[model samples]
Target: MTFSEKLRELMTARGLGLRELARLAPCDSGYLAHMREGRRIPSAKLAERLDQVLDAGGELAALVPARRARRKTPKGKAGASIARRDVLALAGAAGLPRGLSGPVAPELADYFRDQLAGHYTADRHLGPFRLIPTAAAQYDLLCDLANAARGTLRPRLWSLAAGYAAFLGWLYQDGGNIDRSVYWHDVMLERAHRSNDRQLVAFALHNKAMLHADLLDGQGVLELTRAALQEESALVPKVRVLALQQTAHGISLTEDGDARDECDCLLDQAAALVDQIDDAYPWGGACLTPHYIDIQRATCLVRLGKAADALTLWERIMPSLRAAGARRDAGVFLARQAQAYAVHHEPEHAVTVAGEVVELANATGSERMRRELSALRTRMRPWAKEPPGRQLQELLSSMGGHT
Candidate 1:
């Protein structure tokens, strides 16, 4: 696609207006309009900034040609000949050749692992649109390392690759790109097994199970969670608890009274297991806190038609969420709380909470949050003519009708 077309497509996907993109890119909106009309071409620098602003994954930048001062390298790429020569001189002074300065897989692995933690933090606080490109670039670099690594470094590199793949799968899922998510999960499973990282293998399986849960595949959720739990060694506390929780969720979706009993029992067991988590280990449990489990439990309660119980639990959980993690998740929970209130006929409370959810969704540009809140609005349709309901409808409309 032409640079203009790609930019437009990305803006639409990310729900950005031309002025919004231009303002965020710190460029002239008129220049952008002219570029779209093919009257003017974007400079490479502008293309790069646009790519970053739109999270286009370099799509815009790739379509633009570099001005030749011989040739220009993009940011994060090799510098000019002078820079390379300076680097070579420094390496010579250090008694190490330029070639010998190539990446050490162990170091690369550690770097990727550390970066993964930062990526996770970003995932919590930033929307997928802001971070997906960075995540993909990190994964691509890890793949390059995996190809060149040998022996111990090779396995280590693969382990890190698997980690990034799993992370990419999650990023894609949050971005509502399910096909990419499935592809990355399968890649994660393969690489995890190849690297013999038992913990990661279990993690990948549990991730797949959670995906199945999202897809409303109760049986698939059960199967994958069980497979995760059946790993040879004892799984990490968080991983084990997650599997148990997924199993409970899967069972809760079924109509069997006996399964519901099992669901409750599993949840109780999972709660008790939380105390066993060791803080010293680098546990990947960003969403596995006691509070998170309680939130999940509340969701199950609502699923079981116990909206009042869910409302009580939501109230208890609300005070603790200090806007620390994903705005998307926070917005989602707020919408759920609003739903609980709505279902319980607390129109004022529902409308007030829905307003908070919608505002957050708008601020963060989180489609997932918008979708959840929109569903809540639909659920409140019977009360649409009520004062609170009418207020919420107006609020949603003012925020751009479609979720």
Candidate 2:
């Protein structure tokens, strides 16, 4: 029987409807229906998923031709590349192999690397509610191609998968989904290990430290960071700084008497590495610079109750953060500054800055900033019945109680 005939028969025998099978398919449900009617061709992955869904025992998959006819696509601007998602879909449609041997392998790598950079920026502009689903979907598609990839192509594909997972981990963490954040962090570690690249693996392990951060598990962060740094032989400047930053954060969180001194020293060490590093990668932090490290340093100092000092450093670097298109982060930093003000008993300015944070969070839809706002509201408890505190509460209520 033809592929569709067999699919229909299987559905009939199983008492499954097209929509039901399509819902369980790996690809878009709408696309499955179109292919079922012969309005479009089925891809290898699509056929594979369909076979498994219908219990065809690989029969439906085997029906996919070795190759498919290419369709025309709109070309990108002079230098821009097509989105890799489209590339994968087209390859699936044409039954073409993917990997180092595939024509799109090199282009796909470049495309993803570039998008990785763009996403770094997008993370600043786009809220987690918007970016999380997109990144998760991209990770899923990338994983499929990476699994099918072979030979020399495996390294780049795996690296992309791991990196995307890390990105998702960060996004989910920002979205306040701790479990999902940890899940992607684990996926990053698994994918990176599969790639067998020490540097990428180190990047993945370092990402787990971030997952523990939401829970303020200083010991967990320190252990994960130490594990990541053990790959020092594979370390680049970016990973080095990231590992150090987490170390600083963990140290600050600990109750040790010397934690402040140790954390301060680690920040200095990370700073020294900043001058030596000049390369950026898709893995870990390709955006690590002196400013980034300093931001971590200031944040650490704030947590350690060195409010005045941290506020000084934060103001000095505020311009840099703003210029980087990190409006969401900028809002968080403002909240930190406001926190410092509250600690210094400067209630008026603290409340003023808190207002700015509320405005920023509303504009960006950043759960990170929202969490900070909530913290600020709690901090305002002493003054809750006061005008500034009352105003902050009203602002928070306007955000659907996110604050």
* For model 1, the run of ten residues with the poorest summed lDDT: 78-87
Q: lDDT tens string, model 2, 1-403?
A: 5666666678889898765775567443444564565444565777888888888898878766732334232465211112444656566455546542343344555666777777867787766655654565567666766766677776788888788888988877776656667778898899888878777877776778866765778999999999989867578877787788888898888858998889988888888787677665765553353377778878788778888898788789977777876677789888877777776667788888877788778777667777777767766678788877787777778774345
Candidate 1's TM-score:
0.73
Model 1, residue pairs in steric clash: none
Residue-wise C-alpha lDDT for candidate 1, range 1-403, written one tens digit per residue: 6666777788889998876776687644545675665434555777889889888787778887732223433445421222333434543554543454454435545556776777777776776656654555566656655766667887777877888788878766765556767988999999989888777788888889877766767889888888888863477677777778888888766646676468778888888778777733232666454397788787676656678988999999886774455676788788888888877878789889988888877776665677667767877888888888789888888775366
Q: How close is candidate 2 to the true structure, as a TM-score?
A: 0.75
Q: How many clashing residue pairs appear in each of the predictions shown?
A: 0, 0
- Name the runs in model 1 displaced over 4 angstroms: 1-103, 258-260, 279-283, 287-290, 323-326
lDDT, model 1, position 61: 88
Q: Give the clash total for candidate 2.
A: 0
